[model samples]
Target: MRDNEKDLSWWQTFKSVGAAFFGVQSSTNHKQDFNKGKPVQFILVGLVAVILFVMSLVLAVTFVMPA
Candidate 1:
């Protein structure tokens, strides 16, 4: 919506996405090792996803809910 760059830089967001991407990428590459930590990784990802979802939902409701 607003300018892509403001207080935060693109690199910051990109790095976060990259970190998550690598976690998934390596998980696939080393399935055996990944399995050992799969539960932890899954829980971390799920928690992050849920938090993001909840925040977005709250923002949307605030903007779109009936007065």
Candidate 2:
């Protein structure tokens, strides 16, 4: 990271990851994340998001299907 580039905050990291999940991240933000965000943070958040998504899908199916 450059001296002028600050580290990404938790909210910024979350938004960036969320945008990436939807494939709607802007080029500017993508560059910023690449340049300033920590890989571990992004990876951790992405994993958590994926797990939540999977859990939500399971719950939805469980509710909609005749168990």
Alpha-carbon local distance difference test for all models: 0.52, 0.94
Candidate 1 structure quality by residue, lDDT tens digits, 6-36: 3323343333344564565444434433333
Candidate 1 local accuracy as lDDT?
A: 0.52
Candidate 1 runs further than 4 Å off: 1-37
Residue 20's C-alpha lDDT in candidate 2? 94
Cα error, residue 65 of model 1, in Å, equals: 2.7
Clashing pairs in 1: none
lDDT of candidate 1 at residue 66, scale 0 to 100: 83
Model 1 quality (TM-score): 0.42
Lowest summed-lDDT stretch of 10 residues in model 1? 5-14
Mark the 10 consecutive residues where model 2 has the least summed lDDT.
1-10
